[model samples]
Target chain A: MALLEARAELDVIVWPEDRACERSWLMENVVGATGVIVMFPEKVNTELLDKAGPSLKVVSTVSVGYEHIDLKAAAQHNLKVGYTPDVLTDAVADLSVMLALMAGRNGGIGVDLVQKGQWPNFSWSPFALCGPQLSTTAASQTRKIGFLGFGRIAQATLARLVPFGITHCLYSSNPSSPPNYARDAALAKQHNLRAVSKVDIDELARESDVLFVLAPGGSGTYHVVNEAVLKKMKRTSILVNASRGTLVDSDALAKALREGWIWGAGLDVVEGEPNVTIDHPLVKEPRCVILPHIGSATLETRGEMTTRAAQNVIAAILGEEMPSQVDLSTVL
Target chain B: MALLEARAELDVIVWPEDRACERSWLMENVVGATGVIVMFPEKVNTELLDKAGPSLKVVSTVSVGYEHIDLKAAAQHNLKVGYTPDVLTDAVADLSVMLALMAGRNGGIGVDLVQKGQWPNFSWSPFALCGPQLSTTAASQTRKIGFLGFGRIAQATLARLVPFGITHCLYSSNPSSPPNYARDAALAKQHNLRAVSKVDIDELARESDVLFVLAPGGSGTYHVVNEAVLKKMKRTSILVNASRGTLVDSDALAKALREGWIWGAGLDVVEGEPNVTIDHPLVKEPRCVILPHIGSATLETRGEMTTRAAQNVIAAILGEEMPSQVDLSTVL
Candidate 1:
């Protein structure tokens, strides 16, 4: 609606109303187009660019991830790309913490028992329905939080845990970059944490009471949480993935839950999500709490993302610099 | 198990194994018993005191709420009562925050959609499955957190929300007690909040983005969140009850959800819970996420509670000061 209202002198075309725009419809409509907006389901490659007939100036997506867009081809086609990033960091970070709480507290199992009409017959005992406590208790005075990626969202999550009496923090980032000890010390001081250090993936898995997977998704980062990492994690620890599906191996997670290798898992994105069925291995596991890829599904965040995408397109069409234009060279 | 281990020379009578000891069995075995340990299901009353025949010196309950116990009767009978309070505070506070997050987001609805194998058929749109975000977003800068009771647990919960960028706080405590402006100012300064003040139930409902019920359970607080108060709430607000079922009216909440008086609810305790079935109004409402009275259900917290109960009973039996002896006068 914002895009439609903002298009003053320009003619705007929409792929006939559906859940998503079909590729054939987009291909047939892209001829001589000045700007295009796409979602995760659409691919922007050489073929789509060729169909646009060298007249296309901008491609804007209302998402933080641009994996669906072929950045190398876009650079070759001399196109400007825009994506909504920082706007969604808080929304996704909030979901990440919520998933951690759900997974650690047997939320899915409890909901099932109530929905199945079994709660009436369920008996309460001192230890019934007990799970590992997420907050620091007198019995467990120290807590360690670990992150697979220590980017903006991950840091936001760590900041939230500070009030939960978390004692230490450990994270793993891109190994290609050197550890920033100065930055780590500064963050520890800012948060009043006992320690904040970077470590290898295995150490992170072993020491963390809750391990969060917030790394980007792609072949290079795929299956980072595999059988070996799952096995190395504490038996009482929880796993939370809110970033992307492919970062975690579904089979490995299923097997881990079956054998009690780890306590539980909470996932917002799954390996083949939106196609996940009741028969899915993780779905069958009572402790695995799954959401339908709604990490950034907050009305405020989505509105901002759509409005930003529209601004990017409008600015490019007016021959002004796009607000959030992506440097395709760096992406490639 | 802790009680058994600690009882050195005392004759410990065990009830024939069951989920809960029957009243008949307890009456039959409690004859001339010097000390009694009970859970939520067991009521320590005048008749039970008569059954014990002046030998009862202590009645220790492994819970924070002792509504089942007759405090006035215990005071008349010259009995020392013990209840675990501070030990479970962190655990309950953690769950309170979890409930708020789950309710503000569409956690229960999302889980149902996924579990029913409807995700594949469900189409993703920009605003689909969108709910009000729990955290402060750029679009919505200020957030107000409200509490039904601003006691220890409620204050702990408020501490956890500080990192979520919550700006203001409003809480309604006991009307009999005057507002403590000094304490509220100190708390506001400590949390870096814009303001912290007392408000009436209606104003709290209207202004809070999320309202948490953390008051004690009794006739005094019963139905405090009835239809009139629910009607005053924001359509985008959420209601979370981790305190007691009686604080909220189940039928009224169901109707509120059905009519969109509030966005959603996450309840750990429903009115007449454990008896809640699929036919129950709140259980049947997709927006109401119910958990079966597991606010203090953590292995660490429960273990601490049991141990504390044991210590209290043993201390009273040995004529020593019980660690958590309840003043029946104050309770009454």
Candidate 2:
């Protein structure tokens, strides 16, 4: 909505309805398009690339996660791929925090009570609906945040979390770029935190108060948060994932939530997600908050993403440097 | 729940199923009740006071608004009264901010699309679902904010809004107290905002980008936000109410929403609220976000309130001075 509203004057844009459907008119329109804007669900693979022809300059997508789009295909066609990333971290991270708060505070029951008109003018007694509170008070002693992946959006998301009483952060990444330890330490120190990189997922899961998954998608880290990792977490710990649908095992997470393996879970993504149902193991649970993949849905973020994507496509066609290009080697 | 858990040793507590129930019972172990806790709905008038039978020196209730309690009756019986106040301001203020954000960003539609499965992945189009963005940069100007009543909670809410890029603030109070122009100006200056009290309800309604209702409940201020106020606001303006359900005229607000008289309304409180339904006019409207009176529903806030209420009762009975005493004279 933000992108459309922001760039309404565009002469031409390429958008396909679904992955499998490619109408001749849609392909023809793309061939004549001076600019192109695609989304996460729509695959811009070789067929679409061939359809796009030579006029295509930019390929703007409204997603932080670019798993659906083929960067290799775009690179072959000398097409620029534009993706929306850093802009969405705040909105997504804020929602993540909201989810954690809701899960810990019995948000489902509260919303139900209101809908049922069971709210009393004043409640009596203790621990009636007491869940958890997040704060950086001395009483909390040690607090550390864990992220499954370290990237630009994850870093920005961590920055927001720091002001809200997090004392340290532990992250597990693929140890690329020689582990830039000094820069990482400086970043953590800037936020009065100790930034540590864990070699093992168990250490990261067990030691951290809250675990956030911002790791990349696919088999490399698929189901990284399996039963063992969940079991290793402190009883009062929380798990948050705003990255991708395949990172955590939904069944294991459901069991963990039902059996109190962990205190609560806040997932913006889940296994077999967005075909998400009320019957989905995590969906029906009160302790889990399920969003319909709105990580980059904020107006500011989406608009910026669309504009950048458009610019990338334009730069690629004009043979200029693409603003944001994914590593083709990582493609499936 | 916090209070009840805190005093787990004290088992017996009065609980009415609803507002009209008057059934009372005495448990076998009633001899050990060191304190009594009651709210306005329980009718702490003479009969219940006499029935309490002198063993109770302290009575505390969990609320900042204490219109239901009779202070004179408490004083006559030599019973100490305690109520929760300042502790809940932040929670209510946070809800106020949430309401404002939800309304401005078209959250109602967002929820509906996700619920109905109308939203497709990474969707973008010309004018799809654009709404106001809170962040401000050098190129973007801050939005204007106004308050219908400026109290401690309102001040706290204003502080939260500051980070969301609010440039100015205006408030309109009752016909009395003659508007503390200098004080309001000083407060606005403190926050680097252009705070003005010169505006009447009409001017505020017309000029404010966002208008907040932070007044008290009941007859004198009933439906203070009528059709007149709604008519004055900009076509893109939003209204937020977290104070009392009786402050806004639901029919007028509903009609305004239906007519798009204003952009949207975020209501934590509704007139004759909690009785709201999907069939309700406002609920049927596209731009209205009606929350079920969750102004101070956060677990942290509710727990602290319960604890404070208990502490208030304990202190007053022990003759150590009630920590939170209601200003009974303020009640209408």
Candidate 3:
């Protein structure tokens, strides 16, 4: 609204305030629209693009993931695409570390016990409600953190973990991208870590005290943390997924948690989220802490993302370069 | 058991293992006991000292807080008091930071919404489920952290917050203790914080984005964060109490939450904990994230504490300097 109000020269129409814009309404209203800003709920497919006609100069998404956008079709139609990235890295990374702490400390169980009025009956034993400590203690000297995708958010999470006395890091990035030993070495030195090395998915699963799934969501990365990988993880290890839910197999994770293959899981996103109910497999597990896809839901971050998305649309419409234009070639 | 088994010369009698030893059982078993190891539930008062006759040389508690013990009675009885401190610092500190993050990010509300199966109906908007971000963002350039007590756990908690881009710190230590400006300067420089200074309680409440109550629990500090202080706090701020329950007034805090005096609160310890029921005012608040007094509840920390308590008892019985002995003069 701020962006639209700032541009007095342009006329704007908003989807009549609802949780999400109706498809039929959007299709009809977008007929001769010059620019469109959408959230994750709106599917920016070829159909929507076709209805918008050639006048649509830009499609800006207020999210880092562009999976909902038909990038190839947009490119063919000569429409520039922009996504809100980099801005949400800190917010998402904060949630990632919070989830790690929550999962490792039996956060869900503790809260449930309290909320259910069971605490009075819950006697305090020496190790009652005890879970793995997030910070490294003298008894447990070494701590290793693993990242499924060592991207911007993962690296930010690593920086936060340094003070927790984490000694080592292992991450799996795009297998095709050549490993940067120089950058890894410098990061290790900078953070005073024993090692920060790239490794195979199996090694990452087996070795990490806490495994973080921060990879992109796509067919290539789907179900990367499946039953086999979960089986390889330590019984005391924790799994945290702040990335897209599809990157982890929900059923497999539930089984692993039930069988004590992994200690706990903290998920901000589930395979089918917003649709997740109390009867969901993961939700039934006592140790599993699940939040409803709120990884980048912070006032500060959301404000920035909205501004960025608006800026992209305004820029593209004015025949100027989009501030965060997506590379169509990579999407294709 | 390990300690008793290791020492063949000492005669040890074990309590009939229950959640907590019954007072009758403890009284009978303590008769002529040379040393005793107790948890928080077992009070080490003058009556217990009398029941033990003159044989009691030590009363070692496997806990950091010794408020359950009658310190003056122990001092007069010529009994050495030992407590498990420092060992659980990391665990408690970890929880302190976790609580802060949880409070700031609306963790409790989100979990409840999902657990209660309301998430499916909960539609996502640009600002839906948005709470204050724990990490400082470009728009919000500064974050100020406050500490009610600048003790070991508080310092450790501060260390964890350094990476979150907290710019300034305000701590109100024991007013009787002379201010250490030099140490504050060094700490500020070490963490690259803009400032680290001791301030009055009012200033601490007014300035802090998140105020941590880590002070000792006693008459002097009881209800330190009462209605007036709560009123002075920022509406966007958070209050986290990982210390003893007595330091915070539960009703006042609940009112604060109800009336939106502050954004939210994360409490590990309530005024009447272990007994905090569903009807409890704070528990009834949507934003209040209450844990079951599990601040130091970690396997590693508990194990270390148990070992340390045993060692203290063994050492005291042998007429050697007990490790981590409590200064009885301070108690008096």
Candidate 4:
């Protein structure tokens, strides 16, 4: 509600327009709205049947996830549903790379050294404060890149990692419509990547020098990278999680990083986030890089997302084809 | 001696194979040395004469400053004296730009916020933790870049800063030199910079939004940017010192930064380093960025310096031109 008020261009009355205001408040606020916008938070159930009045037209969301909105409600309303997607892929991927670089070189540890004034008196050796350089060396030979869910952002991230000397790629994903093997094969052909899917997660852990998690976060993918899978990872392997926090078991991860099961973890999300505390166990490790969920916060990308979201609502209300609409049947 | 023992190359031999044992242990260790590298502590007068003997051929110091070496000694011995000169200009200039950027935006302070886990819990506002960006907008647009001693490195630093929307540059040099107006003109022509040598140091302080102390350090240049100059500088202006620590009074600088005489200071050198403690007054300021004496420490640059020093010794022994000989006339 606050976001809409701030972005008043959105003028659409829906079941959720004045969810708590009053009986006709939705109609009052969006008197002639041609489009309706929503997110995972708003429940668009049967209650929408009574409130969606004739003025209601289209639906859009600020989120990529559309789990809460009722597609049935949207269909009954005969309204197009719009959602912002793909806009965040590059920005999120850039953050993942930043996290990986910071973690691998112990840059996160330098934070303490900078502020504490210990730099001058600190006894340093060529080997001291030295961490692995991302460039493939004679010893490491080749950096094998892998992804748990190779979606839009994951592919972009892989492209960026290539210049840093990646040798092979492996990935896994849930089977999509008519089977997505053809699509996966086409993409691999395009990027010259080896596209292997839905392999035993253990293979991903063992063969990968860097693993990126790009799958949607939910119950089905909960704790996908658990103790057994983590144990299978190479001791020098790095795990980069930018998608969501729930897919990883934080306690198990802390233990693994502590006991040297893997080289490091770079995370932009943590379960029950925005509440990440200093005492968070992962923060204690020299190899973990925890960003405050700024994956899609680049100036250009965020600005574009905002403008696109606004335009989607405006266009849908004007009774035009939505720029983008969620196809949730694929997910269900 | 310590450096020579660490590096035993087929460069130069300053003593007889039989007299190698009689030579000063320090000189003896730097055997097969092509260039007799000397820094501040190793006096290159008669002491070097007795030590270097006939094997002592080319004298190369690893620093831009070579006042400690004796020119007459080299001339008398028919020895070439080499010093590292222009190799680090770009690297040092790059660091100056980084320091300016970091100080202007208060990047170093964020290290504490992110590492201490104080983010996300409290939402930072539009103006919160915000310092002025390098490029100012229409409402408030004013920025002036200045230098204390505009030499080669200063010129390089100025070139790097031009992209940041700088409109003017004011610098001072040794009053004794017949005003380096030609170089200033060349810089102006190349960078389209409004380069000028101000007669009064206070004039530069009043006009500049950032002051770079690129002057040499010693009795001749000591306390050049003193309280008087700092007082005249804009309150929002910053000071960066990569040249020498003695150019600015450390205590006065600490006070200036603390009391807001100027925005901040970025220092890579201190008056008494290694001996300087965590409790040093300058280190107490959160705005100050004090790097160890690593201006020429980049792997690429250091390797070049070491290799060049070896070449100097090798060439001098072979009666070839020393690649970079120090103008000892300046030291006297």
Candidate whose lDDT is highest: 3
Q: What is the per-residue lDDT of model 1 for residues A215-313, given as tens digits with 9 covering 90 to 100? A: 889888999999999999999999999998999999999999999999999999998777899999988988899999889999999999988899898
C-alpha lDDT of residue A128 in model 1? 85
Using DockQ as the measure, name the better of candidate 2 and candidate 4: 2
Calculate DockQ per candidate and list them.
0.78, 0.19, 0.79, 0.10
Please give the C-alpha DockQ score of model 4: 0.10
What is the CA-based DockQ of model 3? 0.79
Chain B TM-score, model 4, reads 0.83
Question: What is candidate 4's lDDT per residue for B198-256, written digit by digit as tens?
Answer: 55687888888788888877789888877888888877788888888788888888889
DockQ of the two-chain complex in candidate 2: 0.19
B-chain TM-score for every candidate = 0.96, 0.84, 0.97, 0.83
By lDDT, the better pick of 1 and 3 is: 3
How do the candidates rank by lDDT, highest first? 3, 1, 2, 4
Model 2, residue A135: distance off in Å is: 5.1
State each model's CA lDDT, in order: 0.90, 0.67, 0.91, 0.65
TM-scores for candidates 1 onward, in order: 0.97, 0.79, 0.98, 0.56
**Candidate 4 local lDDT, A1-332, one digit each (tens):** 34345655554344533122343454445444556555433556546644656766676765565655677767766766777687767656655665665455443554346456666555532223434444343334466777888788888777656545456778877745234677667766755555534455778899887889888887788999899989999887889898888888888899999999988887877766657778878767767877655565443444555556766776766666667776545432
Q: TM-score: which candidate is best?
A: 3
State the lDDT of candidate 2 residue by residue for A92-160, as single tens digits.
655555555545544444544443445543242334544554434323446677878878656765665
Instruction: Tell me the lDDT of model 3 at B317.
Output: 94
What tens-digit string does per-residue lDDT give for candidate 3 at B96-124? 98898888888888887888988889877
- In DockQ terms, which candidate is top? 3
Model 3 ranges off by over 4 Å? A330-332, B16-18, B330-332
Q: Per-residue CA lDDT of candidate 1, range B201-305, in tens?
A: 989999999999999999999999999999999999999999999999999999999999999999999878678888999988888888988899998999999
